[model samples]
Target: MGRSPAADAEFMMRDTTSHPPAYAPAYKTSVLRSPKNALISLQHSLSEVTAPVFRADELGPLDNDLIKNCAKDGLPVGERLLVHGHVRDQLGRPVKNALVEVWQANASGRYRHKKDQYIGALDPNFGGCGRVLTDENGYYFYRTIKPGPYPWRNRVNEWRPAHIHYAISGHGWVQRLITQMYFEGDPLIATCPILRSVPSEEQIRGLIALQDTSAFVQLDSRAYRFDIVLRGQRATLFENHVQGTPQ
Candidate 1:
């Protein structure tokens, strides 16, 4: 359940051949330093980014969409995410058997995390989280609710636009990556730390998508098509799990 800010920002309007790499170094550092990768956070500038890591290819497909989806958000979420990318390592090569995890706030911009304290606004049955793995195609998909802008503690007037966080893991205990996907056209996208991490000059085109009906996606009953591209050795994939908050 997420939305990328590129959907509204003018900067997201321009087109570029893939996102800008000039900002890649910055992102690499950010991703490495995030709580998910604290091991490399202090060494953000280390040369290990080019180090060869292990890979896997034995993951099966996830068939039980009902179990994987946040049923609290409703059933039969549409397949609206359409994505493409390279099947390479973090250095930008192909990664095999990469397990990916996704979680985001629902249409109300509220997550089901323990930190959330919105009284009278909690969906006890709607914990905000989703898990899935990438395929050899370096692709992944999800059907969830539309992400809504939510308030944050970053600033007095700060708000995090609708977005989905992805955590990927594969062979060699390489560790799963914890990143986020943003919906295009979201208004608060400009100040969001997640988006600010990317290059402002880059064309965040492929990141946005208008609601599509022909795709068999219904906001309430259909699925939203969301695809993920992981930079790894060979595009690896994984299955979905029930890691959301306990019912």
Candidate 2:
């Protein structure tokens, strides 16, 4: 059997101090946003939970290629893009075999979902979902298209930034992370309330992936690099051991 990530990283272990609050008030949709929300005010504790280990044989042929399943007869109509990145733990160690899934709108800001109601034509060739496993070196790469910004019901002329949804599964369910990655120079990023909901400016900045022309492998495709950091179980403990607890 291959090595277990939990042995090296203990990624499934929970650390409340290192992670964002489950309910940040600034994020309107968060259950914790309202003080009267009974769920948020209640005391919570991390449960000792474990998940089944996934083997490589379980993955399908097209799981890593989002464009293949959704595309019609020809290539999808959009700016082709290559999204690649590394998955690391809080201590900066690489986490291999991580399951990474992504989904996004088509070039015209239209999603395949029926309820999107964006008034834009959905690309028949683009269902906009893909998955890939990180390599031994913690590298994961996939081909996709640049999703366009779309308006939401938040405010008048409120448009979301061009972004792709990321769902990463580390060693177990406790390590699973769901977040959005925005384009570095997207104009709507500054005004998007969702991106601003993160309490730490540095954490918010980490969500933006930078365009890298040099990483482009195809003739017509652009490249973007995004690195993800999963919180590790031992990180806070190790820091406390070294620096001592704050007074």
Candidate 3:
């Protein structure tokens, strides 16, 4: 029989050794500020607990479509976007059955969160969050709008680039990764301090999804492909985990 609900919760809460390392040293900005700081010493240790495995029955068909829920009245206001990609492990093997979650600001540069002080009008049709599981080939896709840039107090007159936030969890909880996906050809990409913070240009380049004109429809929306490799081929075991977006 499957593990009881309470038992599964306990397993997820416990630490496991099978998972990758906790935080990456290169992402010091995120590490320093994260709650994990309290346990920095143990961040690199193998875990004794593992993330709970998700049952196929628990996920629904509409979960992967961000726009479907809000389209009851009509399609949300914005250019329709189709983002698709593959998830792979260090050895270039597909990490199937993974859960991927995404959220972003609406096209007007405003988020639904109450704390978002951006003055742009909010769209009643957009909820701005979605989730999907990887297929047998470790591929996932979603439909969303092209989010707009938003101003923040990080610096004087600073505005973030158009991007979507992503949270990925492979078979194990310890394999979880949180990062942001940026659009190609956006001028803001060069100036974004968060992106520049990454030490290697190659790694930074991986974060930007390139535009695919072949997928574009006349008078319709464009397409972007962003393939994610969970860990690089030469990367030390668990050395690179999450590259969380700086909120």
Candidate 4:
């Protein structure tokens, strides 16, 4: 068996603090204005965006600090979840040691905290958080429960669909990325905030909408499938933006 990542990076790690690369561009106002026409002609969207999938990975042994320090950082410590993604550099070459992080709303679309009353308190057993460091093959995994829909203060009190937020970092943040993974068949998807926030059609290029299944999860529970594309991946195109928004 391979040694743990903690030991693997101990000797090689220099400065662990990092600022990942920015998230992909925002959708064009015209495209985001309407959900019906947004996904039309999304041929090479991922190529234009940085991080594009949402996998429910359980927290690895290393995320204890994130778990104990804050409630906003709650992540399920142990559970099987659906994850998604592909491994390829911008030139189509595979990546090595890609890192992925995820944060999402609880079963009620509310965060785990004392103020979030729209939903109940967090499940003592579940933390709604996780992380995964890809292998040489550029793959990752996480175990988490399904996220619930929540209200967003959009357009006079609008709500976003059930979704999860994510970030990808490696080499202490060489080409890090942040984005969100969406669930399939969500009613609120019709008015997704991240999708609606964009006011540019061209910006709304890489929004994965139920195409590839291999990246999806195969499990017994109602787990969702999701995958992510780091800043550089062969075959896929992108619109490099160094900043990412909360999904």
Candidate 5:
């Protein structure tokens, strides 16, 4: 027999303690951004929960191929990488047709934004952004150059680890998640203040993507698998919520 609504709801309940506190002082910027008052929960209106449907045709044929989409003169200079993953709900059911967006600095650690005055030279061919929609089995993949680590002003000599930023939206506004995925075996992961802000070692580990040798393309690109659990005890650490979303 299928599960009842109450049982489904129970499976979706978030473990608040599993996530980092919004006021992590070590993270510095979170100080002023954290909530100043007690929070209130509200029920979602039908319009808020169900609008904004994303169609497959709305995406360009090269939308998911960062390596070629922005190429103008030549291919971007960096190690080729294939990042693939599956998105699942709290109950382990696939989240089909979910939209996954990614943006990152170039292999030299410089972003394409004008405000980014990092000394690293930007590759003319690398625009550093891409998007893809998950299949019926919640699988999605993208090709890009492995990003480089860069220094930040958070501390005197602090540097951010090489990582990719992700924004995933499931059916509607309420089913959205924003997180970062770090590569495995990066020594910087142990010391980066932003990653350290996570409450537990296990939760911090969840944000790291494992190298998937099995998926590596011969003489082409290395692959990394970063599955996303959308809710419950194993939810990926999302920047948008302290208490996880029901969706």
Candidate 6:
């Protein structure tokens, strides 16, 4: 016989302990940003679960290539990288056609935004953003430069590790998930206040992308694999949807 709906749901239920506390004291900013009241669970309305269909034609041919998408004079100066991964649900099923977006600082660890006062210089040719939709098998890849680390005011002399910010949307508005991806072997990962906020060492490791030498482009770019699991026992730590699992 087949498993019941309740059984399947139970199997895919996320382990609350896998996620970090919203108000981690070490991550100072979370203090005021964390929720102040008890949480409430509600059923999703049709509008929240549906609509906002994505189409391949909506994306430009260069939308997935950050290296050239924003180039005006020449290629951006930095270590070229090819990041690829699979998007899977808690049940290990491929999440086909999911929209994945990524943005990061330039090689000097400076954002293109005007509010950023970091001393690092910005690359004139790099926009530091890109997006791509997953294929039928849940595969997605993009090319960009590896961002550098930079200091933050979270604590005296505190430095954030080099990382990429990701925003993934499944089927609807309610399915949008946001997270960060760190590179493996970065010593700063162990000390970053934001990363240390995560309680589980295993889950912390999940956020780090592994270097994939096999996928490297000869003499061009190095590759890294950072697969994402939407929810369940091994869900990737999403910053936005911390309280409950998304349907």
lDDT of 2 by residue, 182-246 (tens): 88888888888776666677877899999898898767788899999886545335544632345
TM-score of 2: 0.80
Q: 1-247 in candidate 3: lDDT tens per residue?
A: 2222222221122233323234544434455664564453333222322445565688777777777756667778888888998999766889787888899999999998998888977888898998888899999888899999987766677778999999987654446788999999889888776776665677778899999888776787688998876642222224354223222
Instruction: List TM-scores for all candidates, in order.
Output: 0.54, 0.80, 0.75, 0.55, 0.87, 0.87
Q: Order of all candidates by lDDT, from best down to worst?
A: 5, 6, 2, 3, 4, 1
lDDT of 5 at 182: 98
Off by over 4 Å in 2: 1-27, 31-49, 235-247
Candidate 3 regions exceeding 4 Å error are 1-49, 217-219, 231-247
Residues 1-247 of candidate 6 have per-residue lDDT tens digits of 1211221222233355867889888899899999998677555455444435578999999999999999999999999999999998777878778889999999999988999999999899999999999999999999999999999999889889999999997654455678999999999999998888888799999999999999999999999999998753223436765334674
Task: Candidate 2: give the clashing pairs.
Answer: 70-125, 71-125, 72-125
For model 6, the local distance difference test gives 0.84
Give the alpha carbon lDDT tens digit for every residue of 61-172 in model 5: 9999999999998999999999999998876878888889999999999999999999999999999999999999999999999999999999889999999999998754
lDDT of 2: 0.76
In candidate 6, list every pair of residues with a backbone clash.
none
For candidate 1, what is the TM-score?
0.54
* Model 6 misplaced stretches (Cα beyond 4 Å): 1-14, 232-247
Q: What is the C-alpha local distance difference test score of each model?
A: 0.46, 0.76, 0.73, 0.50, 0.84, 0.84
Clashes of each: 42, 3, 6, 34, 0, 0
Alpha carbon lDDT at 130, candidate 4: 67
Query: Model 1, residue 171: displacement in angstroms?
Result: 4.3
Greater-TM-score candidate between 1 and 6: 6
RMSD of 3: 9.3
Candidate 5 lDDT (Cα, whole model)?
Answer: 0.84
Worst 10 residues of 3 by lDDT: 2-11
